[model samples]
Target: MTRTQAPRSSPSRTSPSHLLPTEEPLALLRPDGTPVEGSPLVMPADDVLVELYRRMVVGRRFDTQATALTRQGRLAVYPSSRGQEACEIAPVLALRPDDWLFPTYRDSVALVSRGIDPAQTLTLLQGGWHLGYDPYEHRVGPQCTPLATNTLHAVGFAHAARLKGEDTAALVLLGDGATSEGDTHEALNFAGVWQAPVVFLVQNNGYAISVPLDKQTAAPTLAHKGIGYGVPSVLVDGNDAAAVYAVVRDALRTGGPTLIEALTYRIEAHTNADDATRYRTSDEVAAWLARDPVDRLSAYLTARGLLDERTKDDVAREAETFAAAVRAALNVDVEPDPADLFEHVYATMPAHLRAQAEFLREESA
Candidate 1:
């Protein structure tokens, strides 16, 4: 997640409320497109806000295109971030070029916002022979499908950067359900002990596949769990794009590990295969639609005179162009060679496997 920046609050609105999340989710704008009143929330500069909005538009378009590919059998599986666009875009925009991002399977949109090619970002889901894009090229790790495991990798990578005397930070995106995993616990512990620069952004999108947040945990909120590991935590309305961006920017500037739980909803089915309607009601989805991230930002920007009809039209046109290109790219088949299966298996290939590769090579030849 990259482009978000906004403000926060809690019991100690004036006090140094480190480690305490605001009573309510932090937000800079209301659903009706008005800025929240009487809060010290820092609004992002107009330019940054506009950029955030644009990337989100392009990101969502890319997301829909990816989901469409699944229905066309061009992809194996796709977890749609249809309603979680704020969590998908912000925070990555706050990063410096030297920073690293450890994303989850649900974060193809985030990867695109980070300037990754859309086709390369979907290569894994397309069953490509490689990771599709070079991880070094964008400093993004392979998309981790296993829940919460990526957090540990982020901690390790950030700690190593610290050891090497580099000012690098790692932002790891996890779902609400991932907080229960032991890997999240260990990652927090290690990050706290080493004071690593790692920001854990939990997109609490209401469900972990079929399980709702209530069934997932009894903790007051996911952010509170950070206190146990001595990591500072904050809660924000994930739908408020500006607020999300502000909180993430401050957390990174705070100079240590932070955990953020952004309250959002997963509008689509868990994937191209899961049936979301079975677990959630249409009314529930409708309510969230009123608070949609993209709409919230667009409305707020328009009211402030920062966004005009022309700008909106231009953004939409650009998004459509991007989507068309992605569609065209995926329309072509990318065939993988059989011998590639053994290529990255080991640095020093064993004799038996070496014979197998040779046999396959001979067969192909």
Candidate 2:
């Protein structure tokens, strides 16, 4: 079945009656790039909109460049967030400097938007050491590879900050597939129980690594999963940057956990290693391309006379420059130091590891 068709909810699971009244995905922009009637979106200033557009452009270029790099063997692998550029740029742009972002492996675009250097952000995928950049410096957590693990960490950090009386909120990004993990359930439950200041953005990009949403859950919607934990939930058009930013901003102000399920589609295969044509039809992808987030936003801006030919040229140049930098950085080869593997594992190495470290050191010498 196509994504537009509603999935059957399992009879075994049910949501509470007090759930928030948001069954349909909230969308600010129409397919034609006009605002929906009575949309809650108070359009931001022209400058803000322009910046959002720039980031989305840069993000798409980044994804494209990374995917190419992976194919060229410059990087290990890349999970391209090609169609979800709006989801990547908007939420991070809505955040305050002090706020923290916890992202999944697919969220390298989000991390880059959070002011992380592109090279450092892609380091993990490059098979480099550690979480490339300092999380404290950017107020961003490491790009978590394990599904749903970072959700728990985000909640714990938010709860700890609340206990310490710090005005901080954590925004955790997850995929629709992650909702199936036990870690997601536990984290949402605790976040609600503690009233932790956190927002969970579940990008429902159709398939979950070949497993479609129908097989992932039978809940009314992924957002409804939050209501079971006593947390409010909302559905948003993941492709609409304005709607996403507004929804996430409101969630942060609500002073507790909120779940937002963004209905979007992944335009690319799961990763460089996976073949999407095997599981999905090209027709489905073509349909989503018509509603591409970057194009929609660009159309809106152009219609408003905010983005002219010169501005478009400038943004394109900027994106190209950014992509060139990424290519140049990834082209440089750095031989991994054999002894460095022993570093950062512990404050003090265990005896056996110490012996192993020494043996490797002697062998390398």
Compared with the true structure, all predictions reach lDDT values of 0.90, 0.90
How does model 1 fare in lDDT?
0.90
Which stretches of candidate 2 lie above 4 Å from their native place? 1-18
Local accuracy of candidate 1 as per-residue lDDT tens digits, 1-365: 34585544443433335777888888899987789986566988999999999999999989888998899998999999988998988888887788899999999999999889989999888877679889899999999989999999999999999999988889999999898899999999999888899999999998889999899899899999888787889999899888888988887776689999999988889998898888989999999999899999999899889999999999999999999999999999766778888988799999999999999999999
| lDDT computed for candidate 2 | 0.90
Q: Candidate 1, after superposition: displacement of residue 340 in Å? A: 1.1
> Cα RMSD (Å) between model 2 and the true structure?
7.5
For residues 69-101, what per-residue lDDT tens digits would candidate 2 score against the true structure? 999998999999999998899999989777899
Displacement of the residue 252 alpha carbon in candidate 2, Å: 1.1
TM-score, prediction 1: 0.94
lDDT of 2 at 6: 94
Query: How does residue 351 of candidate 2 score in lDDT?
Result: 99
> Per-candidate TM vs. native?
0.94, 0.93
